[model samples]
Target: MIGAGSTVIFHFDIKLSDGSAAESTRVHNKPAKLQMGDGSLSPAFEAELSGMQAGDKKTFTLEPQDAYGMPNPDNIYYVDRSKFSLDAPAQVGMIIGFAMPDGSELPGLVREVVGDSVTIDFNHPLAGQTLTFNVEIVQVIN
Candidate 1:
């Protein structure tokens, strides 16, 4: 059984509320490892893993707040249109990387284009949506 400090390796398939597959670890043949009760996994997510052993499979759904939380309106920012490169003109649904003062890059999705301005959303794409997870526990490192 998985304990609070246990490390778990598993294969997961995540789907949106519409039943559309969002991501799957099986494609890369790489299993994901998570340390329980370390804040690495959400509380609800960890609860689902508790009492599970290797070779076990589980399917569960999470609400927006439980998964990625509701989208934050404050994460939206407007940038000058001139900032976009001609090689890759800004377009709706495009994810652009913006640099931070700390020398790190953050991804923002283009939401809309207006006169001399482009609205970008920095929220995680999966935010504000319900998600379903199908997980197969492969190993318990603990």
Candidate 2:
């Protein structure tokens, strides 16, 4: 059984609330490994994975807040078109990385591009959405 110290490997298929596929490790024929008691996954995710054994299959759903949290208004920003480099023009649906004051890069998607302004959304692409996870436990090592 999977417990706090167990290392479990599993294959997962993720779907959005709209019934569209988000991701699936089965397509790559690779199983994901996770060590319990570590902070690799969210608390809710860990809770859901606990107490399962190898070869077990389950489908669970996570709410927006429990999954990626709700979208923050502060994450949306509008920048002038001139802020982008001429060689790298900003276009709608583009994912661009902007350097922060701490020298770390934050990725933002171009939501809209007007004549002189570009609206970028820093919220995670999955934010504010319900998620379904279909998981198959392949192995467990204590």
Model 1: per-residue lDDT, tens digit, 61-128? 99988888899999999999999889988999999988899999999999999888999999999999
Tell me the alpha-carbon RMSD of every candidate. Answer: 1.4, 2.4
Flag regions of model 2 displaced more than 4 Å: 99-105
What TM-score does candidate 1 reach? 0.92
Query: What C-alpha lDDT does candidate 2 achieve relative to the native structure?
Result: 0.92
Model 1 residue 57 CA deviation in Å: 0.4
Worst 10 residues of 2 by lDDT: 37-46
Clashes of each: 0, 0
